[model samples]
Target: ARPRVGYFYTGKTGSQLLTEKIKKLQVYQYQSMPVVVDESVSVYDAICTMFLEDVGTLFVVDKNSSLVGVLSRKDLLRASLGNSNLEAIPVNIIMTRMPNITFCHKDDLIIDVAEKIIEKQIDAVPVVKHTEHGYEVIGRLTKTNMTKVLVDIAKDEII
Candidate 1:
């Protein structure tokens, strides 16, 4: 009898291994803490929050803390242009409202969220939990996170 060894050939390429690792990544693994703003907050306030938080997207929540909309840098920019009363304009008026916002779950595949971001031409998406009333924002998945995943995979850091 020959000595037994653990080594075996799977006939898979390096790129295939990378692809499999990426495919197995979940949103929660790379999601960041969500930056949220109340729907009633003024556009001015939302803009400030966006800048202060250093985030491109802000999840808009209602009184019950349920996600109701999304605010992006573009939205604030458009609202600021030729608008003297930014404070008077509520974010809800300028936000992408419910039934239109693209979101993901913590357990969802990161690759799926990346596809949504690309297809929608959006910078990020909220990772949420379904509630009786609506969705509750838990985290955020952004292009930066996706980039990190790629970098990690290239470095063979992801097991």
Candidate 2:
């Protein structure tokens, strides 16, 4: 057999190649470190952590460090309103609890996650790993990460 050398055109267009690359992109490829808070954390404290961490979403964990809920900036904001003492309110009281929180796994396609984010009108989703007890928060996938991927693809940096 002749040695296959040099570049050979398979007749795929640049857009097709780009689409394929995007499809192959997984949650782990662009996920960021998750900012987590204990479910018992005060709303005031959770708000402070969110600001300090500069994250739009915060994962709420139980005593076992298993994901229990999710706290978004909106949730904190809502809790802050009509309440003079945010410190007295635990995040779990206002957090989107289990069975309601949207999450993705590391192996999930970024495109699917993006669609979920869009369809749910959320800014971010927690990247989790399922354990015997429950889901463990491992990373965070946000709109910002998706934007970065788009920019990188445009620059051909992902190729």
Candidate 3:
């Protein structure tokens, strides 16, 4: 009779192991270009940009395209519900300004970035690089991006 094969002896770890590896992957491996909106844009226009970009967050940039602020769906919703007129208000009025924004570097581990997102209760983080002027937005790491990595890992697809 053939010997029975136990699950542990199969030598193949399940999807969980693959997911663990994905979480350890570097941010530069999967980070994508951020969808940005100028700080001068009206909140109404910012909302439109969010819809047009099909993204939950937007990186607010200055004339030099440097990272200035971050705008989230909740921010827009809260501002719109307030007495202020959305059409007349610029995004900076409602955006989370720099020096307080949580940012990630391209070399950061995905898991570290994920932890920050969860801890800060933010949907996304701008991946930046130090420039002579200041931190310049290079990419963005989002919950959706991490989800995709997990899904791909589960499928055993190379990412």
Model 3 bad stretches (over 4 Å):
1-20
Clashes of each: 0, 0, 0
Over 4 Å off in model 1, which ranges?
Answer: 1-6
Candidate 3 C-alpha error for residue 60, in Å: 0.7
lDDT of all predictions: 0.91, 0.91, 0.87
Question: What are the per-model C-alpha RMSD values against the true structure?
Answer: 3.6, 3.3, 4.9
Q: Estimate each model's TM-score.
A: 0.92, 0.92, 0.83
lDDT, candidate 3, 1-159, per-residue tens:
433446355454555555566767999988988899898999999999999989999999998888899999999999989846788999998899978899999999998999899999999999999987788889999999989877777676743
Candidate 2 structure quality by residue, lDDT tens digits, 1-159: 422334566677656777898899999999999999998889999999999999999999999899999998888888898799998999999999989999999999999999999999999999999898899999999999999999998897887
The lDDT, on a scale of 0 to 1, for candidate 2 is 0.91
Better of 1 and 3 by lDDT: 1
Backbone clash total for model 1 is: 0
Q: Model 2 segments beyond 4 Å from truth?
A: 1-11
lDDT of 2 at 150: 90
